[model samples]
Target: MFCGGYQVQGTIFLNPNCDPMMDAQLIGGALQGFGCDKDVLIDILTQRSSAQRIMIAEAYGSLYGRNLLEDLRENLDGHFKEVMVGLMYSPPAYDAHELWHAMKGAGTDENCLIDILASRTTSDIFQLKEVYLMQYGNNLDQDIYSETSGHFRDALINLAQGVREEGYADPGMAAQDAMVLWEACQRRTGEHKNMMQMMLCNKSHQQLWMVFQEFQNISGQDIATAIEECYDGYFQQLLLAIVSCVRDKPSYFAYRLYSAIHDFGFHNKTIIRTIVARSEIDLFTIRQRYKERYGKSLFHDLKNFASGHYEKALLAICASDGQDF
Candidate 1:
């Protein structure tokens, strides 16, 4: 149900029986924002299933005078814009979010860069870079260069430029790498770094899990244990979350936030800041998972840790979304 975040109602799809091209014409007219039928727009677009949305988008392109994407841009803003963009643009939203995370911090979120750039399809990612350039008016590579330095930055930037294979990762090969990482960790050798940097950098959580299980069987050590022995601080936390995301992301993040607050004494500013930033993305799904695992609402947990306008802002974004503003 929850692909990444945001609650999706399955009925919001296009009518399977409807003529898709005609549907696009009607839908695009409603979404036009120039005295368009807001009621019709809301009824049709809001109820559209993901597949329907995709069809409508296609129809808008094929049958309409203008792009549906351009129309959405004219009307939607903030969080609503994000939701519309996610459904309209598809996988690029994931890359956009990844780029957002990579650029948001005081320093670059290189982990995000490595994970997203190396894992995504080259064509999709290349298009995403162009979108970033068009939207932000600065080259994505230039931004990456500004955020980091040296070989690590170059490696990340190179990946972002999409010179690598187009999602050409082999699951069988990944499984072998996972085993290498586990074995190298046991050997107390530098090779562990290479294996982990590769595995954690690319590879989906699902693929990683398969490889991880194989790695564990071959070497009696879980990915978490390997990370603990090999890395530290935020990188360590990121790796642990990546490994656990396959199983239970909500619990993993909840555990991390709790530990950071209770044991490490992270300031309220830091806690609220991180939670607020992620609320629009990971927090929605994380909340669902947190509720399932701990029988407590994420909103409630967040309230316990935060207060005042900051709390309201985070809660508001999570509940009603940012577009309501």
Candidate 2:
């Protein structure tokens, strides 16, 4: 159920009984009243798949002669608006916007950069780059290079190339790669960074899994532990993200969701981004993983952490899995 490291199981799917014009009519009514009917917005937008949402957007413009996203911006505000607008974009377009937001302005959001680049598949990255260029009028890789420096920048650029090996993994090569990684960790020299980066960034996820297993056998520690011991700063974080996604992408994202909710006063952007981005991909899997890893359903945690229309919209996208709110 996985394609190129992305799980095919998604909470949101194409609505079999879809009527774009009717849905657009309801959405237009929701936008027309004195106070926007956020309930209607949540119900209509959250229930439709991304492709369906696009159709609805087209229908809205045809019926109302107004852009859906711009209307949402004019009518809605705050994090709720962010979520609504985010749902309007295709996955790659959304990712491109997120990347541009992360890199632009006074400081870089290293975590955002790491989360997106490390998690996307090669095809996703390629589409994202193309969209970024068309939308932002700049190259994503060049922008990332300019925003970052040293080993971290090099690693990000390497990932941005979107040329990681795919489809086949050799046990023999995995063992060799593992040994090379172990030796790099032991050496802890400038050259060691290159060695680790090459192996981690270039190998397919399946091959990396084998390499990680071989690494555990060769050394008494996991690859993550080895990376932690040898490196520090954003460079270390990016490597760990790659390994984490390779091992179990859903689990990695589940942990990210947990941290976003608990690590601070509510890292709402990360919360919204993770849920909305994965909703149509593997959010159901992420939700299951969240409960398994954290001993509580994602819906339960979000209900506790958030309130009002924002919470309702997020829960709607999360969909139901027999979890009582």
Global lDDT scores for all candidate models? 0.57, 0.90
- Residue 273, candidate 2: Cα error in Å is 0.6
Q: Distance from true position, residue 308, model 2, in Å? A: 0.6
Which regions of candidate 1 are displaced past 4 Å? 2-128, 149-175, 186-192, 233-238, 248-284, 292-295, 305-310, 320-325
Q: How many clashes does each candidate structure show, in the order listed? A: 6, 0
**Candidate 1 structure quality by residue, lDDT tens digits, 1-325:** 4432324211122345656677677776666555545445444444444456677788777776677877877776543344444445444544665576668657666545644554444576778887777666778888888887654554466556665432344677766776677765666444554455555545655566567778777778777887787666544555565566555555555555555455656444334433433443465555555567667665666677665444554455455332210
Best by TM-score: 2
lDDT of 2 by residue, 28-83 (tens): 99999699999999888888889999999999999999999999999999889999
- Model 2: residue 239 alpha-carbon error in angstroms: 0.9
* TM-scores, one per candidate: 0.52, 0.96
**Clash pairs for candidate 1:** 12-47, 12-48, 12-49, 13-48, 13-49, 14-52
